[model samples]
Target: MTALSEYERLEAIGLWRADPQAQRRDVILSLGDASLVISDAKAGSALAHWSLPAMIRCNPGERPAIYAPSDEPGETVELDDEVMIAAIEKVHTIIESHRPHPGRLRSFLIGGVVLCVGAVALFWLPGALVDHAARITPQAKRVEIGRKLLTELSKMAGQPCTSPSGDQALAALSKRLPGHDTIVVLPEALMGARLLPGKLAVIGRNAIEGPDTPEVVAGYLIATEDAAAGQSPLKRMLGDLGPSAALRLLTTGNLPDSGITTYAEQLLRQEPTPPPTDGLLRAFRSAGVSSTPFAYALDPTGETVLGLIEADPFKGQPSPRPVLADAQWVALQDICTGR
Candidate 1:
């Protein structure tokens, strides 16, 4: 907001410039009437009406005067000069405050946050609610909803995992995944490796199915298991379930039957869990296997697993023979699918 320039003259009574956007705004000044009125351009709205003579009254100790909304039209108000000046200054201050300014948006943001905090504080927002929510959240709920929504994918179709060669292949792969507590193999049709809440690796026979070597299969399992364990299967499980279900699980040590079934299908299908790249790399480093094969198994896309292929630690190392030989791999390959 700006004041009227000294050189600029307004023909309309006492209208004055408020800013660069507008040279002058409508105003009225009446000297003889002992009162002044400020109105809209069309005089359609009365913004302020003040009495002058009484406003200049001085009866020794004078105090500033104030006005409230009027009940009737053309209501008259009386004030001392000091009071008038104070009132005018206050109005000016208010207008200045209302003027557009840079970074004033902080007031609005602060107000909004204050209101939200007030609402939350007004109500009994449970301190432990967040923790309970984590506990009671269901595992299946961790997965998105709907059919084949990753969480509910139970069955897989495809040829079973063929014995890569024999028990030797299994033994070699087992060596790769030696740290894991349990190894469960499904048919290749099952699609990918799924690590369950326990130290269980759900893999399709196809992981050992095609042209891939036993050590490659072992690399995949070891990586998946390490990823799962690094995150703690139970922690990951609780994280997915959501706060409510997580809270319930923490309290009851169990989830709903539907919750169990919902995720069970996902386990059955072996839809892979995305392994943390860093974790996988670290695990591969620990297992002494090239991550290239597992990376290829996960994403053949050159873009996704290129790094692994390039930096295979076990690139030329002589891998140990598997407990399940190449022949055994063939037998285990289609066990699930043939059924």
Candidate 2:
């Protein structure tokens, strides 16, 4: 029973086979709630039921369109009837449109429960609603929000530095970090790396151009990732939006455009809090990157970052894997210079 009310009870004659080796037999195909029911033409008894959502059209654009119950190489239905083919296609499209993305179902169910809890807790607690919204927000939705915020941030920080060689170099450096999808090297304004709502990481020009090797940039990336693990970007954003927007998010699952704009401006003006040393050390160890270079870069005196310098992950071990090639590091350094 899908949202396609008009296509319900649609019946058509089709030929079906139980397996690829089996002979084709005539059958009556009836479109039922979220499934296609194939019944024996002679006995009128159900033969096989194929879930519409799992239905795969094989040999598309052919006179006799063939379909399989699923991607598995067995049990196919062939329909030469144009009316039946069109009906199946239409129903499939509708069902696919209504189907939730992979993780959306869980997010929706969890969000529902969290929203109820937040509603009751909002009156007594200050940030319960925003925290709940952040916890329940799906990864897909967070990516959308992150993209929007980045667009706004660009207005202030300027567009990310891009050049043919520089782009390739940046891509090479990004591959060293695990899980980070999009990493942008900003020309100026930013002082360190910051993780956005999605798996987007932005690094300052200094982090890229100032370091002799790509390990410094890698260190910054790892630090930002560790920071995000400690405090999610969505939770920080909700805090910036205040309690009213948080309440609205609890009910509507979105914030106003003005709130996003204001927050984006605020982020451009401020530096993100540094992640704890223990977590950052773990990240460096996991990535097999030395923390000494990044530590010196952060504090040339090495007075404040003594812990990072003293406990370098690959200090006494054999040389770890190179972060990037010599040529790539050179290209990355000149990314903003347009050379």
What TM-scores do the predictions have? 0.48, 0.59
Cα RMSD (angstroms) for every candidate in the order listed:
12.6, 25.5
Top model by TM-score, which number?
A: 2
lDDT of 2 by residue, 216-251 (tens): 888888777787676788888888888788778778
Candidate 2: lDDT of 306?
A: 86
Score residue 326 of candidate 1 by CA lDDT. 56
Assess candidate 1 and give its lDDT.
0.50
lDDT of 1 by residue, 1-339 (tens): 122233122112334333334455545432223234555556557656554322322222444333222333323233334433443444445556767876668888888999999878555343344445544455453322222222333343432233334334444455556654445565434655665543445566567566355556666677667656556454555455544555565576556656656555545644446566677767777766667666666676857876666766666343443334555555555444434
Quick one: RMSD of model 1? 12.6
Worst 10 residues of 2 by lDDT: 311-320
Residue ranges of candidate 1 with Cα displaced over 4 Å: 1-176, 226-229, 264-281, 295-306, 320-330
